[model samples]
Target: MAVEGGMKCVKFLVFFFNFIFWVCGVALIAIGIYVQVALGKALVVSGGSSAGTPVAILVLGVIIFFISFFGCCGAWKESYCMVTTFAVLLSIIFLVEIAAAIAGYVFKDKVRSVLKEGLQEAMNKYEEDPTLTEALDELQRKFKCCGANNYTDWANIKQFQANDTVPRSCCRINTTTCNVHPSPETVYEEGCQESIEAWMKKNILIVAAVALGIAFFEILGIIFACCLMRGIRSGYEVM
Candidate 1:
């Protein structure tokens, strides 16, 4: 009777944790989509060099979504094979995420240079590529800044040179009829590169925190799953 009661308790806990894990998988997918849609535009404008990050995130989210479904089913059914598979999948995910987190941290310093190069490339093509133009415009306007370095950087662009005007997105006010030659007081003197880099740094920290938290919980889930499996095996042995 005691053994049965203990097994029941283990089963319930395993099921509950697996359920939560499944929910997390769903959340990952949602977050991946959101990040891709939000940041993918800018990355795309950068000649697709940085596009892999978001795509990888989306792919990982999908894998987690499916693997977590297996985990939930395994826990609910108390199936040894399913539970074993879930354990392996979770372990793999944990390792992959840890590696990704490490790589992101290690390469954090290089992000600015890469972004600067990509943004410059996009800026040069801004007039030719409507999509790129819109993306750059949105970035500039939202960040309340201009050019990769400063408004003067726009002076070199052939299109801007021909028109003898910088993008209105550089203006502090409504851009349509804003100053063609902006003074320090009339427009943002700072460059978008600095603001964008700061914003990216803030987001990176946020992502790291969330990823670490998920990994910590994943460790617990793995323990619960293994314990439930052991309890099943022991119960069978006793029977």
Candidate 2:
């Protein structure tokens, strides 16, 4: 009877821990979502030309929190499947963050190179014929994707405060070395606009899937916590 009583006490403690974890998971999810799309909240600082916040980081943070919650529940209930699912989800979030950072670095270098080439080609085109102004405009549009603002673009301090929604790709970098124009202008380079638009569209689906996965785990955790608590209570009897 003593041994049986000890097991019941242990079960209660485990279930309580799992309940705490569930609360933490819910809190993390709430914070992440708020940071991502806090429409009503005032943005303390603007990220200039960026989609602004590190949305992927926010998403990954939420996922990790929920995974922990699920793990706690799984521990309480002794559900191996729930535990395994949490592990897998956590792994995916980590791997994706690493991959995305690497990709962003590599792609920034590529954008700079393409922009340099386009600038050179445009100068040549303009010099060929003063009357070839039409060609100059077309080439400007062509190089929009490979705009020079690859790395520092998002960190732009000055905003293109405009009524029209100008895509970030068109923003020109006002570097100290620039002799052409002292005041920077948002010049849409050839391909930058289209590329960002395409990337954003693709990114949406990826983000949605991750959010759903987190939600799923949170629900599972709640269910598991309830079951384990019930089991713990039932396990104890005066007999």
Candidate 3:
């Protein structure tokens, strides 16, 4: 009677919130994706990244916000099917993202700094003796990696190290270069920093995939609850 009607009313509210939560989740992911695209090619990041960091933070934040949103909806809907789905999704995303944020906030920065230092050194060296092409040639034997002709190829340093034996000379960009890190007399201490940054980057993507899984389930559980109740006739009618 009164209790039955009250319970149905609660479920209706729960369903509404569940839909809203999923919508938010979708928005966050969309924004995050946009941020990633914009930041990927940023060249002159005065503060580090032209845009990626803030977007990443926003993405994680939105994901977390929606997780709670859907969880609440599931609980209100009074369906373990929904609650369990939401909980599992939340738990997995929480664990993985926390791990990634810790890793990214820690080790990845180190790689970026080192790579920048190395590139700075290379840039200086190039300016000093751009005409002294032979000096550039000698640079090949010094640092065993491939790079763009007159600039630092910080992006592809890993390929050089991918062997049982280290490269005997700079990886030939075409047929001209043997010297490496011909920037300045600083930065290029030993290895390129891109290696660490690239390695960590792959892991960060994994975190996002886990988060997406959670968001997907958030939508699923609510619809399940709706279906569960929809066919039940009226609770007052009884089975």
Candidate 4:
């Protein structure tokens, strides 16, 4: 009776942990998609070598979602094979996430260069691609920034003449009436690279915090799953 009671407790704990794990996987996927589409695509179009950090997170989230199902079903059914598979898969994912986190931190300094180059590339074709145009406009407006270096950087674009005005995105206040004329005193003198770098740094810290929290929960899940599997084996041996 005591063994049966212990097994029941183990099952409940494993199920509960897996359920939360599954939900977190889903949340990660959602956030990953948002980051990739909203933030990554812009940089990719600009000349970034990779689709950026969001793509990695998206892939990890997908893998986690599938593996979490194994854990959920295994715990619910008390299946040894499924539970073992879940543990192995979890271990692999844990290692991959750790590696990815480390890589992101190590390469952090290069991130600004990538973003700067990409933003510059986008500025050249901003008029040609409506999507790029809107994205750049939104970025500049939101950050209250101008070109990669400053307002005059727009003057160097081959597509524009020596004296062509910058995009209205560089304006201190964007409106239909806002002047995009090349006037140093009228527009936002701040550059976008600094703002983008700052934003990336803040987001990196946030993602790290979230990853650490999920990792803590996953450790608990692995422990409960192993315990439940042992209990199941013991019960069978007794019978």
TM-score of each: 0.87, 0.32, 0.35, 0.83
Local accuracy of candidate 1 as per-residue lDDT tens digits, 1-239: 88777677766776677666766667677777767776765676555657777767767778877777788788777788898888888999999888877887798777777888878987899779898889888878777888888887887999877665778778887756564776666667778788777777777766767677778778988998888788766654212
Which lDDT value does model 3 have at 168? 28
Model 3 spans > 4 angstroms off = 1-6, 42-79, 114-239
- Model 3 weakest lDDT span, ten residues long: 38-47
Pairs that clash in candidate 4 = none
lDDT of 2 by residue, 37-137 (tens): 53211111111222234454555556655666666666556564664565455456546655765776678665445434443343334335443334333
Best by lDDT: 1
RMSD of 3: 13.1
TM-score of 3: 0.35
Model 3, residue 139: what's the lDDT? Answer: 38
Which is better, 2 or 4, measured by TM-score?
4
Off-target runs (Cα >4 Å) in candidate 4 are: 37-41, 46-52, 125-134, 159-161, 174-185, 235-239
Clashes of each: 0, 13, 16, 0
Pairs of residues at least 3 apart in sequence or in different chains that clash in candidate 1: none
C-alpha root-mean-square deviation, each candidate: 2.5, 13.6, 13.1, 3.0
